[model samples]
Target chain A: MTLLTVENLTLEFDTDEGRITAVNNISFEVNSGEVLGIVGESGSGKSVTAKSVMQLNPSNSVYSSETKILLEVDGESVDVLALRGGKELRTVRGGSVSMIFQEPMASFAPAITIGAQMVEQLLLHKKISKAEAIKISIEMLDKVGISDADKRFKQYAFELSGGMRQRAMIAMALSTNPKLLIADEPTTALDVTIQAQVLDLMKDLVVEFNMGIIFITHDLGVIAQTADRVAVMYLGELVEQGSVRQVLKNPTHPYTQGLINALPKLDDLDAPLTPVPGDIPSPLERPPGCVFHTRCALAEPRCSESIPQMTNHGEGHSAACFVTAEKAEAL
Target chain B: MNKKPIISCRDLSVHFPIGGGLFERKQFVRAVNNVNLSIPQGSFFGLVGESGSGKTTLGRAFLRAVPITHGEINYSDGEKDYDLVDLPKKQLKEFRKRAQLIFQDPYAALSPRMTIRDIIAEPLEVMNLTSSREETDELVREMAHKCRLNLEHLRRFPHAFSGGQRQRISIARSLVSNPRFVVADESVAALDVSIQADVLNLLKSLQSELGSTYLFISHDLSVVAHICDMVAVMYLGQLIEVAPTRELFSAPRHPYTQALLSSIPNLDPDHQSDAQKLKGEIPSPTNPPSGCKFHTRCHYVVEHCKVVEPLLEHPESSHDVACHRWEELMNIKEIPVANLA
Candidate 1:
């Protein structure tokens, strides 16, 4: 069953001066046992789009009327945006969908013990007693490979190392058995060795729990390791998306191609890094038509005159570029 | 690869004191264990390790930013020679002009109040190398031009610039003094991937143009593999491995280095090789393990490895390894973990 489906997710924020379109009109779906990666640099609006599914964006965010976030839990569908501050929203926020951040220290409360925080989260999400919640939390902790978890559970977040803190965060996030886990730069702060361990654990848990994951990051290497499908975002617009094999091996969009080229590969160290031509434009100075025309080498005059919709390249591979899209259709 | 080294260190170590009251026993965190290193002139020497591996502290010790616990660091640029440890006060101030540092976070390293021109010119003023304000401005302009900063934006504050541009401003500041050796501590780690390439290319080109040695300290292997000519792997405050970049990457000797290389997520999905996955966390630097600090996480452990710590020994051509069984384990493909049992 489909875990979540987002349609035409157009979001805007009201600043003091004016409004900025944080997320352009986009649509995607998450199915159980699949990982969808959203890749982009800063100002690319990847995080903003992920936050929209949970309605976790700030108060000033304005969603388009056509925007729809349909979340399904146990064969029952609910509109996530329509859910006001109540039990339904709570169920969706922590019960069905859970979020783990990059920095584990900031997420955990300073004064409370890790065990207490996990217990509170479990009790709030499920209809269980405190003792039952504690039991479940400890089991989750042990499952995340935290040795002597019971003793560590009583300690504060500061006592744990960086890698250990990240594991504890993952444990807390999974205690409720969430249907979808949104991991935003989860391993960006970890060392390579620790990241490998965590990545392996996450892959295993996805299979064991049989849940969907929306992994958001800027690293293509990580996306290749974890994601089944890839969505390449450039300045609030999703330029291309497809299966991991298609998008990475034969990327149709120029921005996605540039990103892959810029990444230094261990196997081939002689190739020089080719940075994308220009800086990501600030939202205030956003371009007129195709957002990436200023930096895109293949952009034409028509690219600056009108917007291009996604042109299909078969097998769910699509790109929103006049040049590449036309080429794909011609081929 | 055989050029005479510009900087050499022997018995280098940096240990910081932990909390200690009157009744409590004094303890220390041995950040950089006694290690020897030689950096060739005009080479991008990469120092790699995880957090608490003391790469940062080692870099600072070279610049004399941090007080060394015990060591002798000799610096020579074919013009002047200065001993970092026993230098006089006047010579130490003079040594500042010969060495400089670049910080990790470009956002914090640059001042928000100062304009781009002033930020770059501040180093010249502090060093008192220039005679007049016009000379400083000219030097700043020249360096900024090389760093690809727009001259018109020189009046703008750091907040007005993007992350890439802010990094450029800091680079211009560091290079304006014409230092012989520069330690860029995770300089491009905080930037976006697209911008990181630009900064790295700039660093590479500028290194060639200025003819200066660089200690590029980073935890990222891929980045170091591309730019560095030589690489050193640090573990638990010790230099476990050091070799030419190609030699180290192609055939790493140390077990820890092998695990580190294998841990990087290969971009090719089909290239996933579970060669050796490290087991536990790095032991605390304070109460380090008795024999070998990495023995706890090493896959191929033995009773001998648990009793005697191995010194850095060169068992092959130009490759240094700190493992006792490297030579014996070289010909064998796999030493079964069951051997430990």
Candidate 2:
């Protein structure tokens, strides 16, 4: 079943200069027991889209009238964008959906103990006693592989190391048994060994809890290791979406190909680090047709003239590129 | 390994004082613990390690940016030999001319108030490398061009430029003086992947043009493999392994190096990796492990490993590893590079 669905979600931020559309008519669904990896560089609007699921965007963020965020919980459909600040909205925020940010230290309150924060969030979300909340929070901490969970409960965020802090944040995020988890660059700031450990922990938990996860990062290698299905985003546009095997092995879009080529792959040691030519255009001056045409090597005249629609290439694999869509049609 | 070592370290260490107050007992965090290695002239030397592994501290120790507690770091580029440990005012000033540093964050490295041209030209004026203002401008513009930055944007401030362009400016400033050795501490970590490749390529092209050595310090193993000639692996402030890129990747001896190499998530979806996942986090540098600092997390650690520290041994030519049972472990063919299950 689909745990969450976002359709035609367009987001615009009203700045001092002008209203810049941050997310341009994007849509994706996260089913329970699935890990959907959203891969994109900076300014790709991956984080913004994730934040929109819980209506966490700033007040200036204008969502289009066509935008609809539907949350399915216990057979009840909820229009998330329609929810105002009340207990009704709590069902989606921290009740059914949980978020973990890239920097664990910044996500937490430095003044509060890790356990206290976890208990506070749990008490707010669930109808449990203080004692039960504490007991369950410690269990969650132990589940995430933090030893001496009892003692660590009283320690502040600064007391723990970077890896430990991240794990604690994960423990706190999972304390409520959230149905859908939005992890935005959770391991991007961590060391490689710690990242491997965290990735393993998350993979195990997803299967155990049977919860959906939206893992967002710029690393293709990371996406390959963790994500079951991958979505490639470019300047707020979903350029490609497919299974991890299909998108990584047989990438049809030029931007996806460029990103894969740019990475320093360990297997191919001698491969040159070839970056996609040209800079990502400023948000104010978004490209006329395809957002990636300014930098795409395989861009044709049609790509510059009109935006390409998402074309299916068998087995649920899809890419929004006129060049690839025409080739697939020709075949 | 045969090329002349431009910078050499002999038991160099940097211990930082931590939590020492009038009432509290004075303690030290051994950031760079007794590391001995040599970087060949005109080669991109990589130092790889996790956070708190002292990679950055060791990089700064070579540049004399941080004061060392013990041992010597010598610099020799076929002309001068300066003892970096005890350089006086005159020699220290001259040493500053030959060595430079590139910081991790481009946004934080460049001053926002300064123009691009002035930012690049400031190094020359500070070092007194150029005689006149016009000479400085010419060198700055030439360096900017080499770094792929438009000369027309020289008059603009750093805030006006993008992340990639700002990084290019920082690179231009570091190379304007034409330093013989550069310590780039995670220089490309802040930029996007595409821009990172561009900056890395520029660094490579600059190396060929200037014939300078680079101590490329980063936690990223793949980027190190892509550009570096010699790679050293550090764990909790000690050099565990040092070898040529191919040798280290192909036939890793130390369990720590093997685990670190295997931990890298391969881009190939079908490439099965029976990679050994390390058990715990890196131990605190404030009070590291007794013997091998990595023995606490090493998969093949023995009781003896916890007591006796192992010295780095050359089991093969050009490969150095600090492990007791490296040879016997190598004989046991359970694991190898290109680890496919």
Candidate 3:
């Protein structure tokens, strides 16, 4: 079942220089019990799209009038963008959907204990007493693989290690039993060994909770290991979207292909890393037509002339490109 | 194999004194403990470890950035040889010109107040390498072009450039002095994946063009595997394993090295790795475990490992490992992969 649907979401920010579009008209859906990976580089607007789901964009952000963010909660659809600061927005923010960030330390309060923060969040969403909230928080902490939860509960966020702190953050996010979780680069700050442990924990939790997850990261390998379906973003545009296997094994978009080829593969040690030529254009200097044409190797004259619509190649595999989309259609 | 090493160290130990009081007992934090290694001329040697593993400290020790507690570091560029530990002040200035460092954070490394040309040419001015203003500008422009930076952007400040461009400026700044050896400490970690590849390629090409040995320090094993010819693993300020890149990746002897290699998230979803998952966090460096620093988390750890420290031994050519039961553990093959869910 589709838990959330974001349609024609366009966000622009009014900065000191001028008004700049951060997220172009991009759309995707997150279904329950599925992990949707949004992969992009800096300024790719992946984070902007994720924040838009929670209505967490800053005040200067200008959302397109046609933009629609529908959240299905208990079979009732709620338009997220229409919600103001009220009970409905609160319910949607932490009750039905919760978020975990890249820096666990920044999300957590330094002065407050981890258990206190988790208990407070739980009490805010659910009608429960302090005792019941503490009990559930302990259970969530243990579920995320933190040992000695009782003692760790009393300790402040700074007392826990980096990996443990991230786990605590996850536990706190999951304590509300959210239907959708937005994890933005949660494990990027962690070491590789700890990253493996966290990834395994998340996979296990997804099965146990049966909740949908929007995993946002730049690392293709992490997306390949966890995401059921993947979306590739480039300078505020959704360039490609498909199943993990299809997109990674046989990527159609030139931008997606460049991202995959740029990574240093563990299997092929001899292959030279081929980065997409040219740097990513700054957001202020938006390119005409396709945003990625400046760096794309297979860009044609038509690519610079007009924007390409998302052309479907096969079942659920779509790419926005002029050259490869036409070639796929020709086949 | 017979060629002399460009940079060699033996029994290197760098310790910093902590908390001093009139009546309180003095303590020390041994950042780099008895590390022994050699970087072959023109070889890209990699150092891999967690944050507290002292890989950065060891890299700094090569450039004499840190005080050497007790060790011998020999440096030779085939033109000059200097004992790095207690070099004279006059010779130290010359050594500074030959050895330079490329910092990890591009945002912090370059001065935002200065123009890109001034940032790259500052080293030349400080070293007094060039005679006139024209000579410095010519050298800076050449270095900037070599690093693939747009020559027209030299007049712009650092804030005008992006992360990858700033890193290019950082590279140009470090290379402008024409150093013999460069220490790149997590240089590409701050950039995006696509930009990281671009910087890595630039560094590789520059290595061949300049013939400068790089002591590449990073926590990413896959990156080290792709770029470095030889790699070393560090744990709790000690060298656990050192081997050729192919040999280390294919057959890691130390348990920690093995765990680190297996923990890398595989790019293929269908491939399920049965490699042992390391448990617990890296122990606090101030109070590291005795005997083997990694024994606290090693799966195959024995009672003997807790009592006796193991020295790095060359079990075969070009591979050194510091583990007591490596020979016995080598006999047991890795477990076959189970069905993927």
Candidate 4:
């Protein structure tokens, strides 16, 4: 039931200084009706990985020959990375797989009415008349919980509130009946209450539509609330991958443990925050061995000399850390 | 807890005029409206709110960065007292040395052109706190070390540092002035989670070392819960609730406070509290709703809430709420903590 499988995704960007690896041989899969949360900080390449799924990376991006992004569409497997800008690409971009950004305002055209944009998007993918497209767009808007759909449809993006605009973007993205939805920090720009509302809406939509979502965000709380499975990334590497409960409650990797510990818990107010020591190394100056070895508390001497392979810890929980892998093996 | 307040505001209000034309009537955007609070000496006081909640404006008003439209702000440091609203020109410049601000965005706060050393020492030189260049450099170096920045980093520009490093530099610059009062407006908001904790710990340690009073303004509730001694919740530029941090989190009186607390996404995946989520966006400040500003969004809102503006009622020694039905709300038996558990 795997909707998309991204294997050995080594994406490098050609910078003026040199070619820098942004996502280094990362592998993961998104299954049907599943929420795969990609949790990471600034330089984790979570966004780059998500972008690769839609082939949306900039022209400077260089994917390794071994890199493979396979998408299952209508019982047929298609190589997503091989797609160039055309009707076929459009089908993958907005037809089957849709993307939403942190800033909904940026994705939408300010000059055009939301209704026009939604209708235009529908027309682009679906072989339907303008009238039929308009009907579907309004229905989609109403589906995402935008009140007075007909009125809101006529108004431009600027006329709507932040939450409403996000909803509109979601509605547009969903209007195409996209199989996979890439939500990149969808709720980061929103207020807590608004965020809660949006999260609730997304959860409801996922259940109703049974769509696979690749939720990318830095907020662990949001990930814990929404995601079924989680992937922890650091410095363009997948440091850990497991079910949300397993990863959150019993994280084996020092980096994962550090990230969880760093968060301020409302339930346990007295616990002192222990931040992961040192800053994330810049992409240009990526550490030689395990990228996290520089800051990891449990890092051994050997950790600084070799990259750790992903070791299975019971069920689907896997961590890429030499010490943790050894500990798991011992257990 | 009984220490004298370093800063206190009495019916403070900050307003900016908008759209004043020959034919059109002049109107004011009530940024900070009638906020009354006190920051006790050496206590980390938190101001929590949404974007238009006036928390930033209130902090700015305290630092005299924004013009006060009404009421009075008083600053006292156990020795000297000054009415900040109408201080003399010379005294105002002197007051600058006593109070300082730490901005949210580390990337923008530090001047990219200046070296880390020059940036940290600029405050001291402007205030004329140190007499010689060597004295300034020594003070800068000491502050930098205290902030956990390497002495070698002093020569590099801000562009060379990461977000966390730049934030440390910003903190060093703010603290180098030896200010008694520091207004930190979303100081750690820009930082990553791990780095945020580091900066928060540093701030806590620095506060203890210098015994400086902090008016920590942030939109983040969890962060405020971790750091602040006392918490105040603002809605539409008005203070709706104020209580001790523990009490406020444990048992919030105002419905707005309750909704806000419940809305915070808990880390526990299994524990989804059935707390009522608030509806609608904050009303526009230009044409705010009459009476209670939060009435439109409050779940327990009644007809009385729409027309009658409830004044802040001191129900407990440490707790204050502006809700008319706070007493009745409290009288209800405690909701099961099972969801939270």
TM-score of 3: 0.97
Looking at model 3, the pairs that clash are none
Deviation in Å, model 3, residue B125 alpha carbon: 0.7
Q: Give the C-alpha miss distance for residue B49 in model 3, angstroms.
A: 1.1
Q: Which stretches of candidate 2 lie over 4 Å from their true place?
A: B339-341
lDDT of 1 at A253: 94
DockQ of each: 0.53, 0.60, 0.50, 0.63
In candidate 2 the C-alpha lDDT for residue A238 amounts to 92
Superposition error at B186 for model 2 (Å): 0.4
| Per-residue lDDT over A106-220 for candidate 4, one digit per residue giving the tens place of the 0 to 100 score | 9899999999999988999999999999999999899989999999999999999999999999999999999999999999999998999999999999989889999999999
Per-model C-alpha RMSD:
3.0, 1.5, 2.3, 1.4
Using lDDT as the measure, what is the rank order of every candidate, best first?
A: 4, 3, 2, 1
State how far residue B261 of model 3 sits from its true place (Å): 1.2
- Model 1 agreement with the true structure over A1-331: per-residue lDDT tens digits: 7889999999999999699999989999999999999999988999999988788999999999999999998788989999998676886788899999999999999999999999998988888999899888889989999999999889999999888899999999999999999999999989999999999999999999999999999989889989999999999999999999899999999999988988888888788899988888899888988999998999899989898898889989999999987776677
Q: Can you tell me the CAPRI class of model 4?
A: medium
| True lDDT of residue B263, candidate 4 | 87
Global Cα lDDT for candidate 3: 0.92
**Judged by lDDT against the true structure, how good is candidate 4?**
0.92
lDDT of 4 by residue, B228-268 (tens): 99999999999999998888888888888888888888888
Native contacts present in candidate 2, fraction: 0.63
